[model samples]
Target: MLRKIAGIIFVAGEEGVTLNELAALLNLSPTEIKPMIEEVQQTLKDHPLSPIDLVQFGERFLYVTQADLDPLIKNFAQSPLQQKLSRPAIETLAIVAYRQPITRMTIDEIRGVSSQAMLQKLVSRDLIKEVGKLEAPGRPILYGVTDYFLNYFALSSLEDLPPIEDLALNSQTASEELFSLKRWEINLFDQEE
Candidate 1:
């Protein structure tokens, strides 16, 4: 029973499981759930080969991969032969990374196109995920970069990303230069001729 509870928590990921919620789900009391959680924590501590830990975040309990294995996981996630992000996917990732907790509609607004496919690709790649929903009218889903994003980029935190102001300035300069090109308006149909 304890192991089953622990497995449920492990599968919950960052969302976590509250004691009350677990108790209700398992048809047990809060008191009964507490000891089982402690036992699971102890088991995790005693098992050297186990790469997961039971952690408490506020009122919620989560099973997260041990932090010490981040480097190994990062390496595995970034192998060259593994899947790579396309230009649009990379751009979408950058937007989500910077303007985190943003809605898909906002992402589309910034990119000047529907980002549904790109967002789906990023989510499938585990670089971004649906964090929560906005409290507004439609209650749109909010997207955010995952810990894997930091690991893949070798960033200690989001603070380590280059300044947004610098990025904006560089982008503006690059766009101006691109627009100044004499052949910028070249017709695609000419190539087919």
Candidate 2:
């Protein structure tokens, strides 16, 4: 199955393919095929000598040459996956992801700071968007993570997210230490709702 996936990716070339396509082709759901796709990705990465690499950009998986072997190719462009989110943006994104369909006011309340700019930035980046209006006074807009969010983090779905309890710090100091991380790999989960 891994070999088949590799072959399909190799043949797909720069056009690449999507998990949905793979699942459909294999007569499986995206959840059923995601692990196999990950296995194929891991196999490619485990071999240091292999010049190829598999990367997920949004919803598409493209075959890219290893950076170490870039010189071998005539002209190798950079991958869009190289794009990164800021720490605050990541934090804001995490809040929305975990407690999705939440209002900006709610996010601001949780973060203990105004999330207006962060919300705007996230919306502009297509990472998060207004899902609907809350059925309350003023009808504040609710925010939720987009499909691009899952792809950016290489997550198959919200189901793939770890449990919040696993990441919760018992002490305030420990929580500060965790949040102070310079570069987060986005192993985020839910918070108390």
Candidate 3:
């Protein structure tokens, strides 16, 4: 029962498990489980080699790093900062992420510049790829972001992409306005910092 309780607590991680919740799951009353939880806590406390401790916050019990190992644990668990993507690359990637299975010519038209170099760089980094060819005059290659792109951007999936404000991007005027607003927003953010 102690092992089962400890296993459930460990699996719960930071969210933790309440005594009442555990009792309900195990078909036992809270009173019956209190001693077992106390035993688990004492066993963990008595184990000199153990790097974990059982802690309670309000009615919840959870596993936490033992006090003495905080620095080592923090150092070992630190996540490195991701490399920053270039502005052009980000813009191209955003377009691909939002308007996937799109052609390079269409991308160039949207950005009002050639996207050949950016596309090549994105493909090389495995962030974007030539997914297929558009069935048109020359059968221009269609580009889309890969699963790697989602990972690189820390996105669960393409659906996680932020909604493009004012989706009426049928005209170049609307596109220009959107980019201008975005640049203005960036400036405002920089000023706030």
Give the number of the best model, judged by lDDT: 1
Per-residue alpha-carbon lDDT of candidate 3 for residues 7-40, written as tens digits (9 for 90 to 100): 9999989999999999998999999999999999
Ranking by lDDT: 1, 3, 2
Off by over 4 Å in 1: 1-81, 168-193
- Model 3 lDDT, full chain set: 0.77
Worst 10 residues of 3 by lDDT: 183-192
lDDT of 1 by residue, 32-119 (tens): 9999999999999789899988999999999877899989878866653255556666777777877899999998998899999988
Q: How well does each candidate superpose onto the true structure, as a TM-score?
A: 0.46, 0.47, 0.44
Off by over 4 Å in 3: 79-193
Q: Which model, 2 or 3, shows the larger TM-score? A: 2
Candidate 2, residues 1-193: lDDT per residue as tens digits? 7777778878888889999998888788889879988888898899877778899988888898877777746332232223355677778877898889899999999889999988887787678888999999999999998887787667898777655665565435533433444534432222111
Q: By how many angstroms RMSD does model 1 differ from the true structure?
A: 19.5
Model 2 TM-score relative to the real fold: 0.47
Q: Candidates ranked by TM-score, best first? A: 2, 1, 3
